[model samples]
Target: MNANPKILLYILMISALGINTPLSIVGIISQIAEYFNTSIAISGLYVSSFTFTIAICGLFIPVLFSKYNRKRTFVSILTVFAISNIAIIFTKSIYIASFFRILSAIFYPAFISIALTVCEEIAPKGEEQDYITKILLGISIGSIVGLPITTGLGTIFNYQVAMSWIFAINLLSLILIIIFFPKIKGKAKSYEMPFSSLKSKEFLLATIGIMMMPIGASIVYNYQPYFLQVVSHVYTYKLSIFLFIYGLFSIFGTWLGGKLIAKRDKATILIFQLICGGVFVLLYLFANYLIPVLILILIFGILDGMGYNLIQYIESSVIPDSPELANGVFLSILNGGIALGIAIGGFLVDGFGIMSIFIFGALFLLLAFIILYYIIGIMKMPLKYS
Candidate 1:
């Protein structure tokens, strides 16, 4: 099968939108707090709201769009996303901005889902992993460019300007999607039911690990800047650089993960990265030296990037029957776990300290490792890769 350049281009555009998310979010939290004269606790709710809605929608999008045309589905969602981005520019009220965010969240899962679907449809037999990785590379690139640009812009200009950049990215995505994405008209193959494959012990354990990685990563990503600036008194520009490096390394990490998983098995790569990631979480929290903190962030970023890809690759490798639907479940649980992590991390920061969030996140990943090891090690489950 030939790789479609148009589809890849569309993925790049949508991935930019994905990248804009965290950058705009972290920047806005501080401004939004000051704008309303509210506490940081209140501003943090925006992150929770975004991820929570994403989790809910990820569970249902595949089923909802099962019979619908893929092109139409994506265009409709992108239209809503465009409107939401434009609305954010004018809406000063927290409730209004948040309402738009919820709207955007409803459609955001398609960004990944559609890309994966396209890749799978076009990939050669036994090359599914490579295709998925390349599609995900769009996400990696988006984060790399989006974080530094939006964060820095937010610091220099107002949050509205930062928001405008996101809107611009979305507008560009809409245009490319409209111009390039082929109208893929087809009916989906109906599955028996979701979570039907959960009976398999290997799937159950792998899913648990898949769920842990995103939630654990988001715990730090969602709130680390606030911790550094508000709690540790780091300067805004300096923090932006740190965040940029984190995201930049994230892309590299994900690319490396694709290569590693292709050469080895997903389980071995996942286990090593998760353990190392957990250890770095602790090191990041205690390191007072800025250099050490930056180093830890780099390490953590690589682990996270690889881990995210690992989850998707593992799910497809394990279940090969319905890759997109399997990914849907993976995304749903992973996102839900992310919301939970943020909610818990936020509460801990409010009650205990910023550092405590890392402790909590590390524990989450560690627990996931224990579950993963038992299935792969004790039960002697087949590795996803054949």
Candidate 2:
């Protein structure tokens, strides 16, 4: 198998972009508010607006990029991403910071969708799965890295410093792309618009199944702090430690996912989802003890990393030709799932209490697992959804 090293550059570029922005913005929300002399809710526009833009823009990226040079467009996105990070770090006004954040966010889905398509182009023949797995690992690892970097730069020093660090990460990605990536000639082809593919049962089911698993993840992620507080009662430093441990192990987990995908396909998906779903149930059962809670989280992180890659592989399998459309739609749905998970989990917390979130989170993954099983087993669909 020919290993194309440029794909590594692609992975790095995407991973760095994935890691830097959100963590810095989220980690520093309170600090940004304090610095700008604004309320936390107002400062939080940086995250909320950015997330909103990624999802909305994501839906249209494949179609919009059809008339342009993907590489240049992606690079331009990174340049803006870097500049925005730098701008936010120096800006004193919340409104000014919000402007740059929204600017950067608009390009995030473009970067992600383009990166996935490029990874497919550069893979060595039959080594597509390997390439895809590595790219997914790159993404999962970004989330892992975001925590400690944010904890150190945001919590310890200040939000400005955290933003500066993100500035460096984005700048590095920009530089790497210019140096390592080959000339991106133009759009690959006029992809059948991603929205049009929603008519296929296989495509729709894959989208729903893939999206549902992430909702479980988002529920856990969005509510971890609240749930942990309820569990350990005002714990701070230990929570940080647990997150770091979760992240470190997850980097390894992505590699494990790559290995598993090589050996097994359908079984791997079923088992990974079940274990991830089960972890949430275990988390609830052991919430009273700090050690058990941390252990379950660590397991959750590992499986989460593996599960993301596995599901992406499934989605990619469904639409082998139109990778741009497939990735764009999948990402849009993933964003929707995250939003749904967060919103539903919030309501559950307000009404039924924080512990109820675990039940719902577990069900989300198991439901995903069942969907995967039905599609692959009962329906035996070939995913020949053109």
Candidate 3:
């Protein structure tokens, strides 16, 4: 398929904005709880259910859609996403809203898998990682810029307004995609199944490592607004600003991940996991101090950003033959980790306190560090970087 690389990149980014809109709502989760007259932990299911659906559906969605036109599949998924957001905006019941959320999520893995494959196809030889970084910038932008703005709207207005903003973004992405996205051919009929890659011991070990890091990070990140409010006593108005700053620094971290992986490879992820684990501990240790908490947020934000690219590279590297299936599995496991973390975080919040989430986050990261170290340092499984 003939297309402008830059334009394709922008389309991918915009689509990412739509795909990641559910995450942006994390800032307004409390408002959602209030709207539905539900507990905070119950409200968290909105996020977790969506992610869990992605986790389950991501495993097969890519392979199922692998034979269709990429342009059509992406546009169709965005349409469904836009419709789902509309449904969420009008729904008064949380259960109804969550149903739509899951519906949209069912298609998310397919879109992500296609986007990753397109990036690989368009990239110049040896610059695939750089292209992937640029693509991930869309996700970072959605998190930092789009997330804060929508969250502010929700805080100032209502959660429905936030849902409306998501709808608008998806609408915009849909229009842009229909206008500019080129038709890319799908995979050949005779191709390897996505599950085939899982047979390798190295892929399984690497997948475990990737899954652990997100589970660790999600425990804190999914409930960050709560953490800031309860532990640090951050004012309501300033919460959006803090989230924005965290997301902005995360963009820099994404860029840094692209550069670091070239030189350090698996070592970069290991060090990042270690630093992130320590950062979580510090967050728990100095929860009452605003300045120190803010500092740790910055540090964690950078590492979180780095995790996106570094982990994506690792997943793709381990199973190079089936890019669509590989990426699909990556998205599945990533969201699976997020769902698990949210569940664990909610449990901690209800049983112990919000502060306990960080402690658990640190422990999960420690496990991730060990698994990654074994795979790269001891097992000596070869990643492209290694």
TM-score of each: 0.83, 0.89, 0.90
Expressed as tens digits, the lDDT of each residue in 1-386 for candidate 1 is 23385455446546544533543465467876766557787788874677777678875576556556666776777788778878877876778878988887776665566557666676667775677777677766665776566766777786778778877777777777677666775455544444666677678777777677677777776777776776556776677677777777887877788777877774555466466655556565565766666667678778777876677776665666755566666667767876777777778888987777677777777777777677666876665564
Order of all candidates by lDDT, from best down to worst? 3, 2, 1
Per-prediction backbone clash count: 0, 0, 0
Which prediction has the highest lDDT against the true structure?
3
Which one wins by lDDT: 2 or 3? Answer: 3
Query: Clashes in model 3: which pairs?
Result: none
Candidate 2 lDDT, 127-209, residue by residue in tens: 66666666666666565676567657777888778777777777777877777665655555566565455677887887788
Tens-digit lDDT track of model 3 for 1-386: 67878788878988886678777787688999988888898887786787788889877788888888888988899999988898898988989998899899899888888898888789878777787787777777876776677778988999888888889888988999899998887876624575666877888888888898889999998788888887778876688678778888889999999988877787797888889999999988898888989999999999988988877888888888878887888888777887888788989999998989889999989998998899888988777656
Better structure of 1 and 3 per TM-score: 3
**Candidate 3 regions with alpha-carbon error over 4 angstroms:** 30-43, 91-96, 190-196, 284-289, 349-355
| Model 1 pairs in collision | none
Looking at model 3, report the run of 10 residues with the lowest lDDT sum: 188-197
lDDT of each: 0.68, 0.72, 0.84
Give the local distance difference test score of model 1: 0.68
